[model samples]
Target: MDFFNDHKKLFSSALAFFLCLTLVICILPALDNQRVIQPLPNAKHLTAQETRGKLIYIREGCVACHTQQVRNIDMDQVFGSRPSLSADYALNKRMSFLQNTATLMGSERTGPDLTNIGARQPSKEWQFTHLYNPRAVVPASIMPSFKWMFIEKEQLGPNDIEVSVPDEFKKGVKGKIVASQDAKDLVAYLLSLKQVELPSNIPVREFLYKSEKKEAANSGKGGNLPDGAALYTANCVACHQASGEGLPGAFPPLKGSSVVLGDDLELYITIIMKGYNARVPEYGVMPPVGTTANFKPEEVAAIMNHERTSWGNNAKEVTAEEVKAIMDKIK
Candidate 1:
């Protein structure tokens, strides 16, 4: 009995030492896990509205019906170059990326991958309409409507607005109808879900092209601004759109872009001539726009002039003759 009592103190001390050691090891790593979770250097946290929508997405049990990750064999190469990582969001500890992964312990895909669900369909109005009434956009959408997120249209600015927006939308909106702030935030999160490798290399240059040769060729065909704007609205607006905003990330925006208004007018001429189908890219490429293409050289010049000047952009005017000169090179 005396020996047993003496041994009890030693055993208790040993247990306490082991527990403290384990706590030290676990706590230290947890406090610093943010460093490991971040894939991008200095990646920012989700914006306020996106963070709110994330909560809504979780509360609605959307996770029960959808998956936010992709696998290599899933054949979603256009979704981007590869699958996602917890490090992609710096979210490894906040919630296990594995927890959000909805898959069949048995097997099922009742809903589509909501991984990059932001612009999976463009039009912000489409999201609102789909949420308010799914059957309106897709007769087959079985996902229940989230009418709770909507309200009737509200008045925007008093003096500047050309058209009255729905009570739901804010100024400078892009959707088909009205939109909620949460919708904008959710779209931001979705667009930010780009898991593709950031392109690190710039396109290699050969030689700069001068417009002098083309200008000499088009010596008599110079056209002005209004003609170009009219031509653009008539011919180019169907796909590229009236505002040049493009279809979000689906079609590239012409506003504030270098490639569209750049010095290489010849490159523009070739694409317009060929009509764009760059071999199975993510968003569908262009169909032929003229009789065999989108427009005549004069029309193309007018549209280019409109784009380079509109969207608060001020640049050199493109003339019909200039476009014709480039067209001749391509033909």
Candidate 2:
């Protein structure tokens, strides 16, 4: 009773109690988790440029709209190869003594999930153009342009990188849109957001409540052929676009491409599997989409067929057998 009457003693007792609770409930568990969990075996640490870009990303408040998480739901399948695991965040270190590392698992998804954006859209040119003016690449995009990341230069130096801005989105006052160092760093960071492959021993969690429509498509019930349009939308639409007309001066247009319409099936397959750099000065290097995604012969045929048929470019349809034969020869 005397101790309670002493306000300082009572306050000190209460403070000690709360501190004990915090240690038991918060700090202890966090330390235990850190000890038990480890980063994926193949996970790479951020490079100096990527780290700078990450800081810029934080400064730009990108975490406000985009999320770095992929929930274990069928809908989230588009964002990553598999559901995100606790180990995915185990490598995150504190920014400083005062600042905790941001997982960037944002509540609101005002934009698409960026868990695997690096793999989905790897082209630096596309990234630069998109950042300078979102509408330049995606006409229907609601995302605000971060044109401040770039500068208009009358003449570019030997090492300077330029963004290809279309006339419609230029909004007047034009010179070459040169990427600042920060912009390059930011793109580098964004391009490093690839999801690593889980080890073979680890059991993967399946996406829950998958739709019957998707199940039916995956089952190959109809003629045993995969959906070309779906494959294109998932793999190619980001750069080539739904209309098949790629962004001018960034991604090459597939609408009337001679390779797409040409009789040279082998060349087309090679480009898809091995990738193309012949038009580097005019266009960004096309990544080896087939190789990276481990695309099957059927999958490649589906994509090729989709490109050849879509956007009013009629050409001979390819079979999985033809694609497989070419892929084997190329390898």
Q: Best by TM-score, which number? A: 2
The positional error of residue 163 in candidate 2, measured at the CA in angstroms, is 1.3
- Estimate, for each residue in 1-331, the C-alpha lDDT of model 2 and write its tens digit: 9998999999999999999999999999998999999999999999999988988988899999999999999999999999999999887787788877647677779889998989887778788888988877777888998988888899989989977666567777468889999999999999999898999999999999998774113222213568888988888887788999987667788999999999999899999887888656557778787887789998888888878888999988788888899999999
- Lowest lDDT sum, 10 consecutive residues, model 2, at 214-223
Model 1 per-residue lDDT tens digits across residues 155-192: 44332112212223234444323345555555455444
Segments of candidate 2 deviating more than 4 angstroms: 214-223, 280-282
Residue 102's lDDT within candidate 2 is 49
TM-scores of all candidate predictions against the true structure: 0.43, 0.93
lDDT of 2: 0.85
Model 1 residue runs over 4 Å out of place are 1-33, 41-44, 75-79, 91-109, 153-188, 199-331
Q: Report clashes for each candidate as comma-separated counts.
A: 10, 0
